[model samples]
Target chain A: MNPKVSHPRIKEFEVVTNPKIIKLLLDGTRKDIVFNYLVNEPMTVKQLSDAMKKKPGTVLHHVQKLKNAGIIQLVETRETPRGIVERYYRAVAREFRLGISERMSAYDDDTVASKDRVRAALLGLSTLGIHISESDFEHAHDLLQRLIDREAEVAKVYDSPSNHAFQSLPPSTRYDVSYRMSQFLLSQDALYRKTLSDWHDLISHYLRKIESEMV
Target chain B: MSWPSNYPDPEDNDRKPAETSAAAPSPSGILKDFKVGFTLAVKNFLSFGLAMLGIILITILLLLLIVLFILIPILFTLGLPFLIQLVETIATGFQTTTGLTLVMLIMFLVLPILGPFFVALGAIFGMARELVESDGTQAESAFSWYGKRGLSLLGGGAIHFLITLAPLVIAFLAISYPTWNPPSDEELRVIIPLIVVWIILVNGMLSLTYPGIIDGLSAVKAAGRSVRLACQFPVRVLGAWLIITVLVTIPLIPVINEVAFLWAPIIPSDLLEPYGALAILTLLFVIVPAVSIVLTRIYMILTAKVDATYTQGADST
Candidate 1:
C-alpha cells in the first residue's frame, strides 16, 4: 500500500483482505469465471465445487480465504443430513478495479506466476483456434449478435436526455449492470474465444490481400 | 435427559437485560396529540405574528435610516471579511445551523400570514403518524409539553447556534496563522492537533444539544449533560448523526435543487429599486416561509430517532 493512501474512515467501506480471500478469488481456473459465478447469487461451497468441477475441500478453502478478505460474506446457513451445516457465501463488492499503480507496487512471486499462467492460457487458446469447427463459428456469431441487440436496447433506454429513469441512478444500479455483463460474457466464454480467433484470421487475410494487390 | 420444549423457559429470560420501551405511540394517540398541538401552535402563531408585524415595521424604518447615514461606507469596508467568513462557516455546516436558521426564519415569519395552510399541512402529518400507530389522544399531550417547555426549547436552539459557531471562529483564526508566516512543518503540524480537538468538541456539543432540545433542558445544563452523555456513548451518537444526515440529505438533493431553481429566477437584482425591493420582500416574506415548514418536518423526522433513543433510556432508568 502507498504511504500516502489514507486509512478509510467509514467502517462499512474499509477493505479487508487476507491470503484466503486472494486464494478464493484468484487461485482458481480463471479469475473472471469465479467472479462471474459469485456475482449472480450466494452459492454454497458444495454447489460451487460441483458447478466448477473442482474438489469440495479446495472450494471450501478458497471460500474461507475470500470470506476473510471481506470480498465475500457468509450470507446464510442451512441444516443438512446428520446435522451438518451448509454455509452460503455472497460477494460483498460487485467490482474490483486493479489500477496500474497497484499492479506496479504489488510485484511479487505469486503475481508473477499468475501473469505467466494467463500468458500460457492465451497461447494455448491461439493454438486451439486452428481446430475450431464451422458449427462453433456459427454459434459464436449468433452469441455476438444477441449481445449487440441487448446492448442496443440498453443504450436506447439510457441515452435519451429526457429519460430520467436511470439518470443520477445509485451506485447499486451500476453494480447490477456490471454483474449482468460479466454473467453474459461468462455464459458465452467458448463463443467469445472463437470470435477472437475469427477476427484474427480475417485481419491476416486482409493484410495478405493488400500486399498481393500492391505487388 | 431433559426433553426439548417449543419455547424457552421464563426463568432464563430473567437473566437477560430488560428491553427498553422504544415503541412508537399508537396511531389514535398520535393523531389526538397532533390535533391539540396544532390548535396551540395556531394560537401561538397569531400572537407572534402580531408582535412580529410591529417589530418589522420599526426595524425597516431603522434600517432605512442607518443605510442612508452610516451603513454605506461601513458595509463597503467590513462586508468582504464578514461575508466571506459567514459563507465559509455556512458551507462547512451546510446541513446544520446555517440551514436550520434559514428554514426557521422562513417558517416563523411566513406561516402566520399564510394562516391555516401550513398549520393544516403540519397537523395532517402529525395526525397521520398517530393514526398509523393506533394510539391514545396525543393532541393535548403534545401542546402541553411544547407550551410548558417553550423557554427551554428556545435556550436549546440558542446553545446549538453558539456551539456550531465556535469551530467556525477557530477555523477563521487558523487562517490568520499563515499570515504570520509560520517557519516550518513543525509549526504546521500544530494544525492537525487543532483539527482533532475541533472535531471532538463539535461532536460533543451537537450530541448534547439534540437531547437537550428534545428533553427541554436549560442550555447550560444540556451542555453539561451532553458532554457526559457523549463521553459515555460516543459511537451511538456519532452513528445516529451519520445515519440521519445520509438518510435526510440523500433523498432531498433533487427536491431542494428543484425548489432553488424555481425561486432563483424570481429573486430581484437591485435592492434599491421599488419593484426590485418588493420582489425581494415577497420572496422573503412569502415563498421562503412555505418552503421552511416542509424542511422543518423533515428535520423533525430525522431527529425523531435520536429523541426516541433518549426516551427509551429515561424509561429504563
Candidate 2:
C-alpha cells in the first residue's frame, strides 16, 4: 500500500507485498517456518527461537536475512535480564496479495518470482482443499486470473484509511466479507455454469427490489 | 520477452463482448501471452528439447512397424490393383501419377485423423501433467504421463470435432438445400448472418476443453461451462483462445509443408529426406511439447487455490 493513503481507523497496516521479500521467505524451508511465526507478531530473536524451540543464534540469522530483504523491520528495543538491548522485529505487513506486474505476466514459464508465488499458494493447500483435473486446467487459469484482478481492486480502494468506503458505514450498510476456495472434477462444469447464472440473476433481482424499497 | 514495468492499459473496461465500446484486448492479450509462453519454454529448453527428440524417433519406429507389419501385407494381399499401378509407375520412372496420389491421400487423411490424437496424448496433456507435478525437466517425465490417462486426447479431440460439426451442419443445410424458387435478397442476407453466428457460437462452445480438463468433467459439462465463461468474460477467453490456437498451429507449418512435398517428390528423394525428417522431429519433440508446457503453466496459474489469510489465522492481530 502507498504510505500516502491514509488509514484513519486501522491500527495494523497492510502491504501490497514486495516480490523480493516473498522470494527471500520462500527460498528455503527454515526461512518459510520462521516467516510463518514472525508474521503472526512482532517478536525478538529469543522469543522466536523459544517459540520454535530453536537456538537464538540460529533464529538470529533468519531474522537478519528478512531484515536485509526489508520484509521484517525493527519496531522496538527491549532490555533483557542481562541488560542487553534486544530489537523486536515484525513483518512489514500482515497480509500479502500477489502484486500485479506486466513483467511478471510476460513469461510463459515460471520465473523465480512466479515460482515463489506458487510456493506461497501451496502453503494453504491442505486448508483450501484443492483438486484439479486435466480439462479444468484452462478454466482454473481463468478463475485464478479473475480472483487476482478482484483482489487488486479491493486493495486499491481500501488502500488508505481516509479513503476507505466502509469506514463510516452504518451497521445496516456494512456487508460481511467471506472468502472461499472451490474445486471440482471434470464432471461438474455444467452445474457450476448454471449455478453462476442463477446466482447472478438472484443477486440482481434482490438488488433491484431493494433499490425500489427505501432503506 | 520484456513487459513494460507498468501495466498501462488493463483494457478490461468495456471488455464484455456484449458491450460495443472498445475492441478490447483480445488480439493484443493473446499476442502478449506468446512472449510469456516463449520465455517460459526457453527456460527448460534443453531437457524439453531432448524429450521431443526421443518422442520423434519413437514415432518413426512405430510408423515403420505399422507399415511393414500391417499396411504392406494388407495392401499387397487385398489392394493388389492399386499396388500394381504404383509399382508400374515407379518402375517406369517417367510419369508421376499413382504413387503421388496415394501418398497425398495418406498425408491428407491420416494427418488430420490421427495427428490431433497423437498431440493430445503425447504433448499437450503430457506436458500438463509434468507441470503440475513439478518434476524438474527430466526429459522422460514429460512424456511419462502419456498412457496414464486413457484415451483422453482422443476423447477431447472428438468433443472439439463434434462441437465444430454443429454450425457446419447448419451451414451445410442452409447453402446446399435444393429449391425450385430462389429467395429474395433478404432471405439470402438472413441465411448468411445465421450461418456466421453459428460458426462463432460453436467455437465458443468448443473452448470447454481447458475448464473440462482441469475439472475432469465430462465433455457436456465442460461445453456448458465454457459457454457460460465466454458469456461472462468474452474478451479474456477470446484473447487466450486465439493466442493458444496460433501457438499450437505454428509448429505444424514446417511439418505440413514437408509432408505436402513428400508425396509430390519434386526434389530428389535422397536429398530431401534429411531435412523432412529433421522438421518432423523438431515439430513433434521441441515445438509441440513447449506449447504444451506453456498451456499447463497458464492453467496452473489460473486454477491454483490459496486459503484466505483470515482462515490461516494470519490476521488475528
Candidate 3:
C-alpha cells in the first residue's frame, strides 16, 4: 500500500553492493527463496506457490513486485478456453549478481544522485562518449575520475555559488539528458547496418561540431 | 568489469539493420526452415503435444482454483457451505436461464485476459525448451525462465498484440467500409495488398517473437528483431506460415464444413454432429502443438541468426 513503490512493470532496479534493490525486491527472505528457486527455470506463480507452500495469490503479488522491479519478465502467453490468456513469467537472467557492473564501489559512491543531476552528468558523458576508445578509457581512468568529481561538484554547486573558481552554469545554459550506452557491433542485416550507419553519421556530425568548438 | 575491456571505437561507425541483414548470409530459406520445422514437429510430436496439453490443463486448474477462491466470499454471503457453493455456482451457470451479464463479462473480458498470456508463455517456454534441449529435460525446461522474465514475456506478448493491432483496425474499417462508402473494386486494390502485407508481417513476427525472448531480449526488442528478420526473409516466413496453416487447415476441412453446414461429404447426412468435439480435437491435438513445434523450429533458426548478427557486430567492433 506504500504509494512510494511504483507498479512492478515499470520500476527499474539495479543490483549493486546496495540493499536498495534488495529492499525494492521486497522483504529479503521470501524474495531470496523465490529468486533461488526461479534461478534454474521459469515457473508460473501457481507452481512457485505450491513448491514454496505459499498461497497462489500471495505468490502472485510477490512475483509481480519482483517483476516490476525488473527482476522477472514474461516468457510466453497463450489463449485458452473462451478468450482467456495465461502468462508464464521467468527471471530476466539465469544468474543474479549483487553488484554494479564494475563490481566495485557503485561508481565509487557517486553514481547515486538526484535525477536532474544524474541526467546532466549523463548528457555530458554521452556527448563525450562517442570519441572515447578502450585504450583512451584505460589510459585516462584517473582523469575520468577527476572529471566525474567535477561533474558531481557542478551538480552540487547548482543551488549554491561556488567557494571554488568553478561557477555553476546558468539554467538557460544547463541541460539534462539520458541515453542508453551500449557497445554496438556492426552487423550484416541491412536495416541494422543502416541504423549503425545513421548513428555513425550523427556521431560524426557531433564530433565535427566538437572539433569546430575546439578550433 | 565495468571499467570495460572493450568498446567500439569511433571507426566502428553506424550500421543499419538492412545492411546487417543483407551482409549476413541468407536466412534459412522457407522450405528449409519448413523442413526443419516439420522434422522438429515430427520428432517431438507426441512429447510436445503432451507437454502443451499439460501446461493447458495446469493453467486451467489454476484458473479453477482462482474461481474457487473468489467463490469463497460469496459462499459465506449465501449462508452456504464451501462445497455446496461450488456446486451451486456451476449449477447456476448451467441451469439458470436469466441474464448474468456480470458473469458473462468476467468470463469473456477479464478471465480470458488472465489465462491466455500465461498459456501462451507456457507453450513458448515448452516448445523453446524442447527445440533447444533435445532431451528428457526439455519438457520441464520449458518453464525454466518463468518467474525470471515475466515482464519481458508479457511485454513481448503486448508488443505482438500492438503489431497486429493495425491489421485488426484495418479489418474493422474494411468491415465498416460499405456502411460509409459505396464498395468498389478499387478498394480491393488497396485492401488485398494491405492484407497480404499484414499477413506476412504478422506471421513473420509471430514466428520470431519467441526467438528474441529466448535470447533474453525484452518484448519490444524481440518484436523489433522479429520484424527485421521478417523483412529480411519475408518469403520464407510467409511460406512457412502458409505451409503450417495449410497443414492445420487440411485436417479441419470436414470439421469446418460440418460447422459451417456446407459441402463436407465426409460425414453422412443422417449422422449426429459432434461439431464441438471435432473443433476441440482439431485444435488441441493438431493445431496448437503443430504450430508450437513448427514456429519454435523456425524461430530457433532465426534466433541463432539473430545472435549471429550480434556476434558479427562484436567481431567487427
Per-model DockQ: 0.00, 0.01, 0.02
Candidate 3 per-residue lDDT over residues A66-167, each given as its tens digit: 665667765433222221123355666555544323322223344445322332232244445343322233323434344445444444534345433223
lDDT of 1 by residue, B171-277 (tens): 54455444534336786578656765665556544544533433334557765766654444444344444433444444434334446445343323352255544
Model 1 segments beyond 4 Å from truth? A1-215, B1-146, B177-205, B213-216, B252-317
Model 2 regions lying over 4 Å from their true place: A1-215, B1-36, B58-112, B119-122, B132-135, B173-232, B245-287, B304-317
Ranking by TM-score: 3, 2, 1
Best by TM-score: 3
Cα lDDT listed for each candidate: 0.42, 0.47, 0.50
Task: Report the C-alpha lDDT of model 2 over A98-158, residue by residue, as the tens digit.
Answer: 3444223322355534643433333223133332221332344455444444444545444
Instruction: Give the CAPRI class of candidate 3.
Output: incorrect
Chain B TM-score of predicted candidate 3 relative to the true chain B: 0.61
lDDT of candidate 1 over A98-202, digit per residue (tens): 333332334456754555433222223334233222224334444445544454555554446575665556769855765676556544666555655665675
lDDT: worst 10-residue window of model 1 chain B = B308-317
Q: Which stretches of candidate 3 lie over 4 Å from their true place?
A: A1-215, B1-28, B69-114, B117-125, B133-137, B149-151, B158-201, B258-290, B303-317
Q: Candidates 2 and 3: which is better by DockQ?
A: 3
| Residue B137 accuracy (lDDT) in model 3 | 24
lDDT of model 3 at position B1:
44
